[model samples]
Target: MKKTLLAVTSLSLLAACSSTQTVEQAQQFAPCTFPDSPTSEAPAWVCDVIPTDLAAGALGYAKKSAAGIGVMRKVAVNDARVQLAAQFQTDVSNMFKQAVESSVNTSTEQGAIENVVETFESVTKNVVSRSLTDSKLIVSQVSPAGGLYVLVGMDKQAYQANINEVVDAASQEQKLWHQFNGEKATEDLTNALNSLKAM
Candidate 1:
C-alpha cells in the first residue's frame, strides 16, 4: 500500500511538470493574430508587421458610430498619430539614454542627464506631432460591425529626416547643451539611429 501511494504521487508530480512545460512552450510559439473586422479580415499592418521599407507604423481604429466614413477616417488617423508620436518619443528617449550611458566618458553629472531627459520628454511630444503631418494613411478597412481601421506610416527616408530634426533641435537647447558634453552626446545619439531602423 505504501509503495503504491509513493508511485502515484510521483506520477502526479511528473504529469504536473510536463503540463506546465507544455503550456509555456505553447505560449512562446503562439502565432500572431489580429482581430478580424466584422466585414473583413484584418491586415498584417494591424498587427504592427511593418514593411521593410518603412521605419515606423501604427494601427488605429474607431468603433461603429452614426458618424460617416470621413469622420471615422479622421478619428482613426488622429488615433494613429497619437500612437506614432508616443512610440517616437519612447524610441528617442531610449536612444538618448543609451548614448549617455554608453559614452566613453561618464563625467557628466547625473543631475544634468536627468534634467536633459526631462526636457526632451516635454519637447519630443510637440515635435513628433508636427512631424506626423508628413505621415500618410497607407491602408484602411471597415469592420463588419461598421468600425474603421487605419494604418499610418512614414517611409524610411522621411522617418530618418524626422529623427535628425528632433536630435538637432534637442542639441540646440542652450540649457541642456550647457549642462554636459552636448556635441559628443549628439554624435552618439545620431549613431544609434540605425538601430531604430533595424528594429
Candidate 2:
C-alpha cells in the first residue's frame, strides 16, 4: 500500500511541475500590446512581433505630423527602413566576426580586423539602402492620438537577392581578404558567403 501511495505522489508532483512550466512558457511568448492603440481590438501585427512569413520586418511610428497622413506614412516607412538596415548590418557584422574568429589566428592585428569590419559596414549600408526600396508596407494603423504605426517587410526572394549582393561585395573586396592566405582562408570565406546567403 505504501509503495502505491509513493508512486501516485511522484506522478502528481510531475504533473504539477509540467503544468507550471507550460504556463511560464506561454507567458514568455505573450504578444506586446501597442501603446495608444486607437481601439481595444488591434491586429496581431500591431503587437510589434514580426510575422514569421517575412524575411525581414520592422515597426515604425510617427506622431501627428502637421503635413498630412501621407507625410506621416512616409516618415514611418522611412523609419522602418532605417531600422531594417541597422538590423541587417548587425546580423552581418556578427556573422563576419564569427567566421573570422573561427578561422583567423589571434595574432592578426586588431586594427586590420577593425578596418575590414568598417568596410563591411559601409558596403552593408549601401546594399541595404538599395534593397529596402523593394520592401512592401505590410500594414499601417492610426492611433486615437493620430500617431501612425507602419510595418514594412522584405519578401524572402528579395531578401535573398540582397544577401547575394552583399556576398558579391565581400568577394570583390580583394584588399580585405589579402591579409589572409591559403586554402583555409578561401574555405572560411566560402563558408561565410554560404551563411550570409542562408540568412
Candidate 3:
C-alpha cells in the first residue's frame, strides 16, 4: 500500500509541474503588434514606409506594360496627373459653387454668377492640363511579378498657384456684371483661394 501511494503522489507532482511550466511558456511570448510592426507571418518588405512628400502630394499608381519601361513611366505619370487634376477641379468647382450660391441672390446676379462659373471651369480645365506636366515622380519599383510600379506626386503649392490664377481671372469677369458685387465676389473667391493654399 505504501509503495502504491508513493507512485501516485509522484505522478500528481509531475502533472502539476508540467501545467505550471506550460502557463509560464505561454506568458513568455510577447503581445502582437500590427501595421507599423512586422510579425513572423508578415514579411518586412510588406510593411511599406510611405514618404512624407508622397503623403502630402497627390499619389498615382500604374503598372508596367509590354510597351516598355519608358512608356510605363509616362502612363503612370499621366495617370497621376489626371487624378490630381480631377481632384483640383472638383474642389475648386465646389468652393466656387458655394461662394456663388451664398453671395448671388437676385436673378441678375444669378446670370452673372453662371457666366463666371462657366468661365472659371473652362480656365481650370486648361490650367490643370498644363500644371501637371511638371509634377515630380516620387517612386518607381519592380514588382514581385516582374512589372514596374510607378508613383507620381504633385505638390499642393503648384496646384495652389494655378487655382489663384483662375480665381483672379474669374473675379475680374464677375466684377463686370455689377459694381456692388465686386467686393463680396472677390472676398468669396479669396476665401476659396486661401483654402486651396492651405491644402
Go through the candidates in order and give each one's C-alpha lDDT. 0.71, 0.75, 0.57
Measured with C-alpha atoms, the lDDT of residue 143 in candidate 1 is: 68
Worst 10 residues of 2 by lDDT: 30-39
lDDT of 3 by residue, 1-199 (tens): 9999999999999998787786658545344222322342322122233344432234444464778888867776677667667876777777766665655544435566676666667766766666644457776655545444445554656556666766655556644334335565656555554554454
Tens digit per residue, CA lDDT, model 1, 94-115: 7766765665246656787777
CA lDDT, candidate 2, residue 50: 81
26-80 in candidate 2: lDDT tens per residue? Answer: 5564544557753455556767668888988888888898899999999999898
Q: Order the candidate numbers by TM-score, best to worst.
A: 2, 1, 3
| Position 19, candidate 2: lDDT | 76
Best by lDDT: 2
Report clash pairs, candidate 1.
38-144, 39-144
TM-score of each: 0.70, 0.73, 0.53
**Residue clash pairs of candidate 2:** none
Off by over 4 Å in 1: 1-41, 181-199
Question: Candidate 2 lDDT (Cα, whole model)?
Answer: 0.75
Q: Sort every candidate by lDDT, greatest first.
A: 2, 1, 3
